[model samples]
Target: MRSHHLLPLLLLCILFLAQCTKEEDTSPAENLMQEASKISYTYPALSTEPMQKASTLTAAEWNDLANWQLWTPQLKLGAGRLVQEKWHFALQHRYTVVLTDSLHKRITDARITLETSQGTLLDESRTDNNGVSYLFLTAPTKPEDLRLKIVYADQVFYIGDLNPQNGRIEKQLNIQRNVSPVMDILFVANTSLATADKLVYLQKELKEIINKTKSQSDSTLHIRLGSIFYGLHAGNSVIRTHPFILQPEPTLLTFTKPYTTVTHSPETIDLALEEAIYRQAWAKNASSRLLFLLLDTPFLQDPGTITRLSSLSREAARQGIRIIPVSMGSMNLSGELLLRSLAIRTNGTYIFVTHPEEGLSNPLSTISTYTDEPLNNLMLRLLVKYSKLN
Candidate 1:
């Protein structure tokens, strides 16, 4: 009942509060999943409301960033049950994710199967809204490969050899979702000397995709190919060259060296696009022409440039030219948002190249052939869609 007794009691309460705060700061689950894992969430904006969002953030940031909410799910006793269960099993494994569409939104009801590096099935699970599913194996384990198969509707995604002996536990899986056939495609490259390496790589890759598609289809598919090459201020301050149609072939034939480079100067994508409006050979062939732009920088950002770009986008949309812009280079999300806007506005695909051979919607590049199966599947899907619309 004295002042001394009250002081000791107050000190004890302060210490208790500090302990609680420290616990909240770092739990085992948080520690496991909080390793700053970067994930890309690409959804067409709910509206045209001008706002900025992070394209790269921690795994913790992803939960809150999904819908622009500032809240994350509170940690619970079962927060990382999958993590805990793995320790008990000899053949331990945990969360696997399923992403659908080019937007990479999580597929809620996808079926996931865990298997050994060999041909044995370990267990099965399904994804929630977060596209995460967990698995447990009661059998004894060996130091072999680990793999997963995710099936949704007609889509089948396979990610195998996920855990080698030296692999990390907290893993993020990326699988390409190749849709049905597509229309005749035109792949454009900006070959300004600065981005010349990227352009060279793109041309070689695009040619391979064309060749692969031809080999798969016994010359049954009818495909038309258009190729466009623009350089520093290409088509601007001079004449224009939007779509250069390749020769007719049994299968859709893509062009290699469809164009010859005149000069290497600063890239003027605005001028390149303006010429695209008049690229009738490609646009007239199909109602909605499919053009893929691989570039090292965003379009020029001046008033005249912006005006030309806006006009080009509108015209392209009207003439059935959907611009699929692939943003390369090391530009951050803020800078790359310009490319995103072009995709959204034209109702096309916006893909930011997170790595040399990943996070690609089209998933076709020179360095990797991971797209062979899926790309073939998508080509067929597009044919059906394009035929129906035409």
Candidate 2:
């Protein structure tokens, strides 16, 4: 009788122990995934059909079919000849026009081109009177440093900050040739054949432009940005989404992309993580400024991933690091709840991304407002808060 009772008790204890061990083992990885999800997200609802129509243009009359507001400046922390080995960029604009006559039928063949210091390239298109226009580019390795320019019709649009020193095209070429660490761009093509054609065309144009600018040196990255999950080809636009995120610490921004695809490998993750940590370390020791983490929400759902990120957050907190999670989720309530929980747990801020276009522009507003405040007042407030934390 005694043996029988002990056997049952021992089995029950073993079962409980096994369960606890499983949870403990997954906890770390789960946290990582959660944090990553909070850093990235997906919103299928934002998807709409691409526009395809002919342009109404006389041979002599030029039309500016692409929109330019969506472009953002991509800056780097490196000094000497720097190259963005492989970066992705996304350029979005809406193209629409009023009908000059009743029942107007005009082919608005709209296309987007990327102009770098090295050269000019064309990309995917949606031709319509008024609709969203998106373009992607992968820079060539030849030009060490360059400025990316957007061209539509006869006029060239300047998206980045640099101005053309010589002739616009010549100045751009010079920059691309002179830069040291070369840059190569990876492109994620969209699902449509039209989109792929657009990207291919852009690459071809870029090759010609590069050849005209200067000479090739190093090979850049296979891709700069990619979907966290799948079904999307890596593209320049995706990589360019968070240009500031790649900067060195004291000013580094973090991002989690939704939709993982084959192009996104362990190597890329490791590189990005290392860069971020290095920046954080620099800021902590040098400027004494707190590091801010910018996380996208929808991407942080899988429990396994969350566990891993949670452990990292704990570690960061232990070292007096501050993480700010910017929730950019366009999912339903369930997804929102999961993201919010992670943000709250990490002691970070969460902002739901209802519209990609809106969310992308909102950051600028926030930054601008903060910049206008008096520095002394801001410093005093921060110092007071730090004292309280101590």
Best by TM-score: 1
Deviating ranges (above 4 Å) for candidate 1: 1-182, 214-220, 233-266, 283-288, 332-335, 355-390
**Across residues 1-390, which tens digit of lDDT does each residue of candidate 2 receive?**
000011334335544554566453433223222222222111111112211221110001001111011111111211100112211111111112111112233212222333455455433232222212222333322223433443334334344433333212221111111111211111212222212322333333333323322222123211111111112336321222223222123212122233334322221121232233332322222111133322232343344444444444434332323333332222333333333333322222233222222122222111111111111222222222222210
Candidate 1 C-alpha lDDT tens digits along 131-225: 43444444445544667776656566667656543222233335443322234566666654445544444433444445544544434444556
Backbone clashes under 3 angstroms, per model: 12, 72
Which runs in model 2 stand beyond 4 Å of their true positions? 1-275, 278-280, 284-297, 329-342, 353-390
In model 1, state the lDDT of residue 271.
60
Candidate 2 matches the true fold with a TM-score of 0.24
User: Which has the greatest lDDT?
Assistant: 1
User: Would you give me the overall lDDT of model 2?
Assistant: 0.25
TM-score, every prediction: 0.41, 0.24
- Find the 10 residues in a row with the least total lDDT in model 1: 56-65
Q: Candidate 2, which ten residues in sequence have the lowest lDDT sum?
A: 54-63
